[model samples]
Target: MHDDAHAAGVTRAGAAFAARRAELRMTVQDVVDSGALSKSALVNFENGRTWPRDGNRDKLERLVGLEEGALTSLYEQGAGMSRQDQTEGLVRAGAAFAKRRDDLNITQVEVAEQKIMSVQALIAFEKGRSWPREMRRAELERLVRWPPGTLASLRNAAATPSPDLDGVSAEPPADPSTLMLDAVKLALTSALDKLKALPADDAPTFIAEARPVMASLRSLQALASRAVRANIGSVSAVQTLEDITACFEDLMGRVAAHPAASLGQKLYVARRKRHLNVQEVADILDMPATTVAAVEADEQELSDDYRERVEQLIRTLTFLKL
Candidate 1:
């Protein structure tokens, strides 16, 4: 077994990084502004949610006063995997992919020749150095004969916040559908923000995850269909408003059901369902209007006790169909 210091260093690499960064008085933006790391990559790595790619790995080690390969070693030690499989949450998934391919005696070149992905891409994926896009990930999972979402589950398991991490908060975990929606939101938003960088054909794959955007786009298509049916007659503004309202309400209901929805959305939806105003709910919870507004907007993360009270109120109201 490893000694205590080494074990602590490996298991708490993120905390170590954070503490070192604090010593240097460096904010997250500071590290990003140095042009050494992308914001997304830094956030995930520093949060212990991902392994750093090779280039970033080197830079981060230098910045954090670690020996060459020290961070990598720490991560591997923590992950209980070899260098080849130490990638973020892809450790098990990558191992499974490699094992399945090897058992069939299929070479990486042969897999690439099948036109699934480039040889280099396959190599990187197997080494856990990079992630495939959702489409490619799904295809790869299928090729490996794994169930849909198996790799996704592994990734989520890797990225899940450590309860010991300070300043990170949690809600009671939601149902599977809600968790899926939250993942969809993160993945879709990240992809959409880089839309211009992607090819035209790649756009459609992300659309399914962008439910609200898709809902709006579908509404427009429906309106066009109705107009075509009417032979270009003028549309009714009232009908349009009603249709829009229905779409919005439907969207809100779905959002409310999503686990990632801010506490505010849940509160708003629950109160609205009971035909109660915000003030009424606020009074019932005995919280100030400002606090209620802040919670809904996610401007504040509540203390454990306070959050428990709010959760209790929500449970009571939900049980009452209010």
Candidate 2:
């Protein structure tokens, strides 16, 4: 059955590709001879025997004069037909996990910091873009207070067929806006918590800690703004984020007046003022990007050896009026 569904999806996507190629008056040899795509891959793609990788898809799209992701989107739609049941199962599991997390007021950042998984991974899982491994799934279930095997059971039930369907109402999946809102709220709450916990008497330490929190606030603000523009988010959420950002800015302003900020803080502020990303700075300093991030975040102590290098970098930034 799975093979049949897979073939159907492949055929649908392949037919579309073939039609487009034909419409363009292009032949298989014509595409292959261009050196952009291999003959075997192109043949398999057009013969409904395989799907194209991202790079191959892009090459083909450009060669055939199709818009970026045009073929990929169609292919996904065709392929999605086969995963409808599994998709439904993941959606249900994700919803359950989200509800439990919300109920506990646990933030995604907290979960990530605990080494359960990354924020991106958590978002993807919660949005049903993918599933976690067995161990990670178990960890998530435990973290959310779900009984052992609860997630497995939900997924299993979704994949299995049901009979005598009477009075069983399916819950609608959460929309994108709702999910984005949840993310904004959780991230905002986490940032606020960090702000509240910042040391009062330690100027350098405060600035170092607050810098990352400030970055998070700005990101959340941007996210909320985009959602509002899309007409899928509430203005009040944006307002709240803006208000928090203003307050945070005021606090950072007062802290900036202090003269005892650390070298790391100075580097961080200068880097941001110049609009240079971590990788850019890393390239300039010939240091690993992760090292730069750690230094800025105060997660790693800057060695004395890097002190001269950091001082020179700051001097350069100052010369640039950063």
lDDT of each: 0.54, 0.65
Ten-residue segment with the worst summed lDDT in candidate 2?
155-164
Positional deviation of residue 230's Cα in model 2 after best superposition, in angstroms: 9.7
Return the TM-score for each candidate structure.
Answer: 0.28, 0.35
Tens-place lDDT digits, model 1, residues 1-322? 3454333334345534554453332445445644558778775665556556778878776554457887766554454533333345565556667788898787988777655689999888777676665435545655666654455445434433456556545765555433433433343343345433333333443322433243332333333333334433434423443454454455556656665565766776677677887567768877554456456534456778768877887777788932
Off by over 4 Å in 2: 1-169, 182-260
In angstroms, the error of model 2 at 146 is 29
Task: Please give the clash total of every predicted structure, in order.
Answer: 1, 0
Error of 2 at 263 (Å): 3.4
